[model samples]
Target: MTAPEPTTDGTYRDRIIAVEPGGNEFIADADRHGRPSQLVWTWASPNLEFATIFLGVLAVAYYGMNFWQAAAGILLGAGLGVLAHGVLSARGPRHGVPQMVLGRLPFGFKGNAVPSTLMSITAGVGWFATNSVSGAFALSTLFGIGPLPALVVVVLIQTSLAFFGHNLVQAFERFAFPVLAVIFALASVAILGKSDLGAPAFEDGVGGLGGFLLTVGTTFGYVAGWAPYAADFSRYLPKTVSPVRTGFFAATGLFLACTTLAIVGAASVTIATDATDNPTDAFTSSLPEWLASATLLAIAIGAIAANAINVYSGAMAFVTTGIKLPAHIARALATVFFGVAGFLIAWWALADAAASYEAFLLLIAYWIGPWLGVVFADQYLRRGHRVEGFLYDRSYTNWPGLASFLIGLVVSVLLFCNQERFVGFVVRAVPELGDITFFVGFVLAAGCYLVFCRAKIEAERVAL
Candidate 1:
């Protein structure tokens, strides 16, 4: 459990333009620099884009929630996710490793591969593609340069930032914070001014408890999706950093940005309800030409900010999968691989962005909910224990944790999934129950892990 020796001279400490060395290795003490306050921007800047806003749009436009209903659901769901994010972020400085590496404590080295690979794919290709499409659409809307060309431009900038790695990613997010925040704030005001706050839910939408829960799940998916990457940013901070302040700032920034923008999306859709085909264009159509243009630029910049983290953390997660590669270049190579894969996926997704995105958001919550369950349960059981050595112990295995996770995932999805492609029997039988798969999965996984992992964790604690 002893910390890794401080290697190198910390040359990349403040060097934003430099390619960050190492791939999911323990961060040396020399490299541990940055304040907890910086997390505010690190978290905030990414959510200041159209993707966050679109979550709200889906609540009302797709999920039959009234503005107030959507707002309440957004608050409940996003608040839960943000709380989890703060706790995870607080673990970073103490661990000095990527979140997926820390995940070894729960799922063990080999078993951890399940969630690690899932995170790699979800964050890398899934989110990368989602944001890339949004950014490209914004560019096309702003400049009439067409989607393909705009996609190329967006992908290159984000991929470059991610390729250079963490320092550049953090710096870019910090730099982008003010610009994206200001424009989105203005757009929110304008959109709200035009919105009908008292408007009733859409008749054709998924009304009642089903609609409300769907809204909650969608918003939860959007915000909580960032939880796995929480430590990836904070792992570089000095160990002396206050966990409370770190969690507070990270949670505050995420809550403020995500809630405000999503509310704006819900409000905007009250006026532009028929925007299913092109939600991005519909979102900005209500604003003045100048403001709209500025908003489009912000969305594009925000996409880069968001995807940089996606690709960076995705690479980090990919490396944690026990893949053999030159340590120095493993993460960088993974970054490139994800970037290319994401670009191709994004191109295909642009054809049906709205429908595709709704499914993607919900899909994120499906696995994440159960994964969070197992990890949090494991973390709780191992409290006050130093298990850092287990991270590098390739032979360590936790099949019970793995079993619980899969059980929760499969059972919940089978009974409660409610997507366009598939609806679970629970919803099919009782339509008002809504899609509570995330809630069910989380409880099932956490309960199962707690029961199954108790003896193992006790043995581990005694051994330590």
Candidate 2:
């Protein structure tokens, strides 16, 4: 696990080509490497893909917001998520373990299984599937290949990167960053060049305040999807690294990439009315053929960049479930399993990419909001207390955390849900309210956890 000494040039580190060892275990001091600023590209490259762009597309194309309105939602939504990401990621170097593994502090090794299992499926399979669809579409368009075959190619590449593990993932992202950034920047210019920036909100669409809120939720959902995986990438940084720098670089990268691309997506739809039929193609339709082809390639590469982290962190989340297996290769094996599952799901989802993507994004927000509520609340309660032992304490249980999470989830979904599949009664009665389930869920869960866990957390602190 030993890493090479930092080079004078500040460029070299561990063998990026080697398969990373361990499964959600604490990264040893000898292995800890890299600076905080590098987190920028590590977070940015992934969001440069079409999946992120479609978030904006959904705002203008489906949710009926004008470009200006969509931009506002994108900023507000992505801004909040990015801020949370910075705060969460700042805890990584101190913990020196995968993000999900830290759940043991609040939920206990056993209770943490709930969120771990969900994240494993969500990040590994759900997000993997979601991003893969866009990548496959790009490949299919670029190569004239069938969607299924294109998906297979994309999945294999993404999974292989995850299977090899962290260093490779970081290196890939760094390599991908410049390429993705340049192409997306050019495409955005082209898209905006043809856009009607003054276009009004569509009358037939969701429209007005409801449309704005939904757009906000959707964009937040997109960024929130990355929240749980924050520390997984940063755990290898030296403990002395500045948490502020770590968070700032990561958040800035995510904010810039997601916000910029989403705005481009909103602008693209101003001209490409066929966005509903095929988002990826419609996005590139405004550019010249050569630039469009390059943009398509960038989109495919960006998807792979995003899913590398997805599958890797998904495996890390699964391992945090405390499931016994061949300890050495558990993460790698899980990566393979999830990769296959994601491919299948992606295949099924290709039939209706636009609808499926929108649903998946909002669903991510629903669960993640509550989970984050409990995590953040627990962290706040346990502040100034040394709770590292709890990370591996099987007997350590925090029933309050679990209770708060479930209560928040159930109550919010039953009251404020606004999805097409199942609108909550409250939302149904007031259709213009849109979805605030994620926000309500977070507040409820956090408030509940603070009330229920205070005495217990204090007692645990005193015991420590």
Best by lDDT: 1
Model 1 worst lDDT window (10 residues)? 1-10
Error of 1 at 140 (Å): 0.4
lDDT of 1 by residue, 72-143 (tens): 999999999999999999999888888998888778788999999999999999999999999999999899
Pairing residues by index, what is the TM-score of model 1?
0.97
- The whole-model C-alpha lDDT of candidate 1 against the native structure comes to 0.90
Q: Which stretches of candidate 2 lie over 4 Å from their true place?
A: 1-13, 272-276
**Candidate 1 clash pair list:** none
lDDT of 2 by residue, 161-264 (tens): 99999999999999999999999888888888889999887777898888999999999999978989999888889999998999999899999999999998
> Candidate 2, clashing residue pairs?
none
* RMSD to the hidden true structure, all candidates: 1.7, 4.0
Q: Please, what is the whole-model Cα lDDT of each candidate in the order they appear?
A: 0.90, 0.88
